[model samples]
Target: MQPSHPGMTPYPGQPFYGWYPPGGYGLDPSDALVTPPGAGLGGWFARCVGAARRGWRPLLPILVLTQALPAAVLSVLVLAVDPSARWDAQLASDSAALPANFWSDLATLLVVVLGGSLLLGVVQAVGWAAGTWVIARQAVGESAGLGAALRYGARRALGLWGWTLLITLIVTFGFCLCFLPGVYAAFALALAGPVYLFERHDPLSRSHRMLRDRLGLLLGRVALVGAAVIGFSLAASVLESLAILPFGTTPLDSPGTAVGAVLTIAVVAVLTLPAYLAQLVGLVVTYAEQRAHEGPVNAAQLAAELG
Candidate 1:
């Protein structure tokens, strides 16, 4: 027999991961988002694939606008303001001294990269929130539209962006200290976005709690997601780098070069869409599973909470 109460966790090792329904897997067979802790990797995978299939209509446009386009603009900006031309000059001059404007160029490069990161963070905030809304809706077989999802994103973007910036700072500080610490910080804070959206308070601490409670499982799931997204990103970067080699250090010098640069970036930007989809679906669904491990929840409850 199951625990007398749905919330009771009999095993000390299991913590908040209580009993599922009689089906021996999830809370309900009819729902994709209710996969409890005992449902295993298969359950989580099914839910992720289901969320993607159900939510793609809204997800595609949301990702393209917030994720892809901003990325394209940032790429263009970085290439346009590249400081590498000075390096070429320095090499050609065969001088032991640095370029006269080397420091200035380096400053400009840092500004563009940092500034572009901040702007891209804004769009990514919107995309993450909107994508969550769609995933929650479609997980329960309910319709989620692009307009409504985007509107919801607009409402939550500021708060999410703020949290993201804080996480970024923490990660940066950890990196300053050491590489391992930075990676640990990233894994720990990975769930903050979904936690903020679904619970709205102390997301950083709560996400850390989830990671602490189920370290191995959460690490495996999150690492898999990271691998997929990072792999796709590396591939895109390589393609974009190769595509721009013909244009030289300063691609914006001529109209033809500028057009080639933009087009190559545009292609690479489109290629980023899969990374976006995998990231959104994988993390959100994984977060749901973490919630299931914590306490009683279902697709309907999550959908209601998302609002």
Candidate 2:
């Protein structure tokens, strides 16, 4: 008989199995079997880190292709449709005779920009859903590859997009009412993705149900994740500015330079996709913990059900 793998844990209701090698067990040992901490914010953070470390292979590519790729494409499009370039050309041209199709050009640019924004939003929502799915699988000690995760995410893409739109509208409305309400609403709805993915329920209603009595803990944890994201993002922005210092000032004025800038930003986005994944993993783990708190549920069981 094969010896028990130190990394494998057969938690209650969940059995641990060793990975097989080529012509062996039919599983890859390199795919770490991670069991998320039972409860608490510390455990949540730890599980997020563990999940990222073990599942980066499956998670990173999905995030880059689904999230960063669309952002990069949109960035390029924005540069191509730059209003400043058109304005500069207009000013440089003969003022008495406006360029033909100037209005049509402007209309086309507007349409492209609007359409690209919508497309990017959809891509991000889908990416988040997929990333969450992967994290959920990893949290419960199950393994999933990029293709499987993407297919799963695509299946629920429409629901994820709808949920994202609903949450955005609600948060926007909350902000209009009051700043605090808006902040509260954002945190309150933060787990909608996990709820939608795992519970297979309407995002808003299920999210509200999850946050019912656990609002305080959930809010605190969400705030911690938000702060980390903001802090890291700010640091990345600073580093990015420094990195582009050698490119000279006003690098985006010319088309060639602007393309370079977009590529640089896209590269940075690709590198940082894991950070976004960590946040999602934390949220997924938290959702499972919350469910466990409500009843006799565990991460492995959730993973099996989600699987």
Candidate 3:
């Protein structure tokens, strides 16, 4: 029995999005940016790995600036808020009862911490969103100008921001509810980005749709990405340790002190830059995949050139 249309075709050389043709000068809007067939869990992970390998170069600087700047700002804010208080039983009990000077210091600390936190949060959001756009552009092998990057981010910033806030609240509230289901919910919601980008919907809407349509795949992929992230983070931690000279005391050795301040700072610099750079590459490829095979970024639709 021959069916009119083959429902289960193999992933061919031409991508479903048709962004690029085989040996073509540029991608055709009409052509499908097809995935290679048999791309299951292993294949998907390989795609992530491959994307990271290819797009590491342009992604490094942007990632470093985006991640490091906000992190540094937050650290400064924390230090400013609580300058040096040893955690003895007595001190812990009487932090508020210490002295007039203590009250004055506390007030100053609150101002710095709160103000810095707010500022850093906004910048971090913008920076991360922009970094995502840059990675997406690179994934598609498209020209990524600052103007275009900003526009891409700006278009989706409000939705992304709302999504971030919503997820943060979910995780925060989850932490209060005995912690297990909250973790699952947080992981389950992680696919909102791919959904957001491809579906071109608000994060909340995307989250809902993904939950309904493909929760299993979404959760599975999130776990995969999380595992990969953790593995790389562990490797970075090891490298950070190695970066210190052979003879050096670790910061953790000292209680309530910046014991390995130098090492900590160095590690943040070394690990953050490269890790994000690689991640950005993976993001680009995934974006392309979703734009093609997945929902909204449809090749057939875009081919009509409505815009």
Candidate 4:
């Protein structure tokens, strides 16, 4: 066996000479202990799962508060403001005597709903940025606390948000053109977050370039991770509904029922956090795998470079 590179650290019980160059070994030992020696779809999934297991402690809270909390809060607010029953009551009663501010009330509700949606987007952006930092640290066998992750994410929040908006617009435009083009565009730009956070490069163009010839592998890995997230999310939604069933039959009608519904949603948010973490881990692994294919580099090396 050849000697390991000067800066490389061999895993315990693994000889220094056993260390292979970036793409040569398939997966980096420092990044993934269980993944096989190649950066294939299965290897990527294994690495992601391994990373999630190892870094769940720090990853969970950040994901819950940043990604899930805002969403759950907004959902509860929307449910509370639902105007269907109220509108129906007004219609049945004297239509001419409808409340003076009925239209104004509706306008106010619309503004609040839109504002809540915007806030949720901002929170998710921060979460994604910070989560990326945490994953980068974990990939190199390092640990970062929630505070450090949040701080790092705050610094990058604006950039990440802008990137997200740009990508959304582009994808939306592609969809406007045709469904197939939109799907193609979405898959092609999937690496924008990782590329933006880690490489500090133009994520849109860089992600497209990195995925130029590896579309099939990227899509397969994404589909696997996406399916898992969807499954977990559906399960969480079902559980949330069941949990809130005891609150009351008319959850939207009373203060007590509303409070119970909100709490249930919050709990559900925390429960489904793992799904978000899994998706993040998969993306990080996918980014590292793509980098390996592009050149002779491993996760540790990428992490070091980002640092």
Candidate 5:
């Protein structure tokens, strides 16, 4: 049985509405009189699963392209410039005075690669913010066009980009200030996105707020999703490892070894699609929970759109 509304007149056989967070708080966790945290968690998990099922296909290609292009281009440039062991070996043998031109060219190439990577990082951070905003709009039931969503996100891109750079610097400085705390600080800062996404709060402020909130629930959901990701990643690693097992004595030290490597990569790419989808699902669910429990966001739109 379902209740028509919260705490008004109960439907026949319907439980009371005390299970919900409160009046004006979003969705009810369940029909129970006293809903436990586990019930809230379960609802969130289900919401994540449902949202992922709907949005994955439309969103994934964009996500991949956004992340991949700059990374691939930057990596290629880096590899092109970086001196390989073979080159170093050849140079070592011919230590009969290397040409000044070689040294200058190598130095120039290294600088170009490094500069390209830095530039790519700035651009990619913007792209990631845009991607997240697209996911956010979809969660909110806006029939937002990718172009429009990206444009909206672009308005905040500099803020997102600057925040990321600032965090990177903080993590680096923290590491220098104290190696152990720095490592912990890096992981602790991961909650900044949920803050930005759910509370519409700034990343730095979210970090502090989440610290106060004990991050247990958020991290719990993230861990569940991360487990799924790791499982897929491990499967891929296993396949790659097995490829080596087939040629027991033969070392994977040549172009021939690429046959198995390529196959493994292909399989991994195909399978990891679901894991990536799950990540988006987890992200949306986190936001949905906020909309439900916190009255700031219009949960009515989510129920209609995501329903």
Candidate 6:
């Protein structure tokens, strides 16, 4: 027997969620723990936190492989090719003009960073898709596992990566124009990933509309998420810097110290786990809230769309 509700019928076997808002699209508040039924900021926060709690199990392994491990490897490569090794020795000898290998080292550093970032873009694409899939599914109480998410990631990686690249270019172009523009671009596109994952059409226009229509709400929410991730990364970076200090500026000078520094970088990478979780959960939850505001949407619809 289904419980009677005006204007909307609960899903079969689905427990009745609380009252629907006058303007809500039939999604009961109880359909999702991670997505409130068009709830306000407080609801968004609650769902964000709840999604994180439910999805962390899968999110962790996905982030560890696609984000943290790659980050550690990239750091090791950067450190290994660092021109600072020569600069450190030169400074110690009181030579101040320029290290002989400065340009060469700097060039190597640029190449390493550029190349690594390009490749990292690919893996990060996988992470974003997989993470979103897991979170959205979990929000709707669907069964989602690490293997399934990874597989989903592979399937969506290409199209999502292209969008990711487009968004990156948009931000880059904004930066090229000015700092303020860049920040604006970032906040506007902050929800682009989740939008693309769920909507799968005209993401750029859709995301921009969401931002334009609800500027303050979206901006504030994204800012909080951005702040959290940046703060965590900054803390991890500071820790890495402090940890490698014992090895001095030229941490790669000795095999023993080099290994230690590498280990420190790896640990720092692992420390970024929460940042990944925050970014995924916060953005997805925020997007869901935005959709709820726009029309009738719930965790199950989102989960189905994510597929």
TM-score of each: 0.89, 0.75, 0.65, 0.80, 0.63, 0.87
Clashes, model 3: 14
lDDT of model 2 at residue 266?
Answer: 76
Record all residue pairs in model 6 with backbone atoms less than 3 Å apart, i.e. clashing. none
In model 6, the Cα lDDT at residue 62 comes to 98
What TM-score does structure 1 among the candidates reach? 0.89
lDDT comparison, 2 vs 4, better candidate: 4
Give the C-alpha lDDT of model 2: 0.67
What are the per-residue Cα lDDT tens digits for candidate 3 across 236-277?
667655644343333333443353554455455556665555
**Candidate 1 residue-wise lDDT, 122-190, digit = tens:** 889999999999998887668888998999998999899999999999999999999999999999999
Per-candidate clashes come to: 0, 1, 14, 2, 1, 0
Global lDDT of each model?
0.84, 0.67, 0.50, 0.73, 0.52, 0.80
User: Which candidate leads in lDDT?
Assistant: 1
Off by over 4 Å in 1: 1-26
Q: lDDT tens digits, residues 1-307, model 5? A: 2223222232234333333433433234441111223456766666665555545654565555444445545543553444554455667778685644577768867787767866765665555555555555554455645565456555655655666667788888999999987755655665565445434446675565444465666567657777887787677557656654653323334556545544444454555556555655565555445333323223333323221
Model 3 residue 280 CA deviation in Å = 4.7
- Tell me which residue pairs clash in candidate 1: none
Those runs of model 6 whose alpha carbons end farther than 4 Å from true positions after fitting are 1-24, 33-38, 88-103
lDDT assessment of candidate 1: 0.84
**For candidate 4, what is the lDDT?**
0.73
Candidate 4 shows a clash count of: 2
Q: Which is better, 4 or 5, measured by TM-score?
A: 4
Best by TM-score: 1
lDDT of 6 by residue, 93-148 (tens): 87766877788878889999999988888898899999999887787678889999
Per lDDT, what order, best first? 1, 6, 4, 2, 5, 3
Model 3's alpha-carbon lDDT is: 0.50
